[model samples]
Target: MTSTQRPRAFRIPAADQTGAIEGDVAPPSTVRMVEEPFEIVEAADGTPVPVAPKSRAPWLSLLLVALGGLVSLGIGLSLERMISDLFAAAPWLGRVALVLLGLAAVALAAIVVRELAGIWRERRIELLRARAVEAMATRDHTGAQAVVRDLAALYAGRAALAGGTKRLDTLGDAILDVDDRLAIAEHELLSPLDRQARNAVATAAKQVSAVTALSPRAIVDVAFVVFSAVRLLRRIATIYGGRPGFLGFLRLARSAFAHLTVTGGMAVGESMLQQALGLGIAARVSAKLGEGVLNGLMTARFGLAAMAVCRPLPFIREPAPRITDVAGELLKGSGAEKPAP
Candidate 1:
């Protein structure tokens, strides 16, 4: 091995070749990886843009307000005159009317006051709900519980005042129950999921409160009472006439008869004209005439029933369901499919 040890076998460049690395070699300045910072480019103009604010057309509002005021004044003057006339005719009837009017006025005033108070309370409740939601979102269970308690108290008071007829009281009680559940969830069974559920409950309560606050049940009740009182007063007036009240009744009857005569004559003339024009057609269509007549009668009966039920055209209520039943029978003719016995 010591013999002329051949130079270590090495792959050396040939005499004609120049020295160079075998593969590609990257320069130190060459980029291996690149990262960039997030940047928001601004407009070249460098001017800040302005946002337009919303505006209401105050002139329209003012016009509506003025019109409402005029209408109210006219109504008030008319009502006073009507009341004075009624009183001059019959003192007892007048007294009853006055009492009824006073009751109606008091009820109306109470309704307005209650509604305004409800609106205010509802706003506060909404604020509490919002705060509760925010507290829940932020994981402040204690703060959320406090807000919920305030909301429950506010709703409970509203529930008591809204009375039993309106479903508002029921809705309030429901919201309070929801608050109790949320409170339990926050204290006894604390969990992130429970916080979300509580927030949902608060939102639902807010929606329900808003709807109940705006319900028209109170106004409807007031209207029903006022109308009922008016009906009673009219009955009383008919029963007990003040001095010469019989004369008033006579005059009213005469006026009513006059109106009926004119209207009835007109209706009869129109009916006669229609009959005259359709007589030839009726003769031609005699085979189906009975069916057509029956259909028309049924239609009239149905119309009467609808009017009675809806009270749209001022009809006595007693005949409503009877007429409705007749209409139903007409609709269910013998040719129609029979029902199971």
Candidate 2:
């Protein structure tokens, strides 16, 4: 008797098909790719997650390090000379200077500790993401379970996730498949945080758009943009459990920029601008309002990059945030959307 395999559904191939396999990676149609291709792998969900290429030598990091060292050395020397002069001038003044120095030293030490902790938190997120990727690649159920436990621990303190965290804790002996487990973890743990992150981004975009439109001076626009960006980065990190301090924020920003470069996010950002402009045209937006839309688009673009960096897990159970989605929301709230007649 002859036996035949059942018919299967068709998909547009991203690569040439061999009889045995379609391609080395998942199809691009399944994944929402940015301009650059980082090579796609199927995520915990059927959709693929694209990994960005490693960036070039970290010149920004080197510059930051050199500048920090130089400033620190200059400050130490200045303080020492000040204390010496004060002591020579008067004993009481010297005692006062010493006391001030001690207090400053303690405060400085505390700041250093917080910065290190922030860096560690960012690193921990990177490690966890890597682990999940590794588990997905290898189909290592044990490793995936461990990753889930670690993720649970990371969000244990999040009041919103308390119930999900407890449920995740019980899944160790329940879920068997690696992808299924990871997907479940993402659904339970990262879903609420994803909503919050999206909200933060949406709010920041609207604020930047509003401020830029109304501000008469370029400097005002620049200052507000910077302020909003820094706050948005911190808020995104906090949402994802990064809790980055200043130095950590710098590191986070660098990673976000790297991500942007590798993913060709700037081009997509341009696409966002184009989309916004299209909306603006329909609504007969004024020149100033149009400019505001572009500025808001830029902020939203960078915020998306930052969101990608801060996210602890890859997009598994949900679609990654698209520039168009955020821009649509931003435009609808502003004067860009067409008015109902």
Query: Which structure among the candidates has the greatest lDDT?
Result: 2
Candidate 1 clash figure, as a count: 0
The segments of candidate 2 whose C-alpha lies over 4 angstroms from its true place after superposition are 1-78, 266-284, 333-341
User: Scored by Cα lDDT, where does model 2 land?
Assistant: 0.84
TM of each candidate vs. truth:
0.30, 0.74
Tens digit of per-residue lDDT, candidate 2, span 103-190: 9889999999999999999999999999999999999988999999999999988788999998887775885788889998999999
Q: Across residues 124-163, which tens digit of lDDT does each residue of candidate 1 receive?
A: 5336546655664576656644654553444343333233
The Cα local distance difference test for each model comes to 0.40, 0.84
TM-score of 1: 0.30
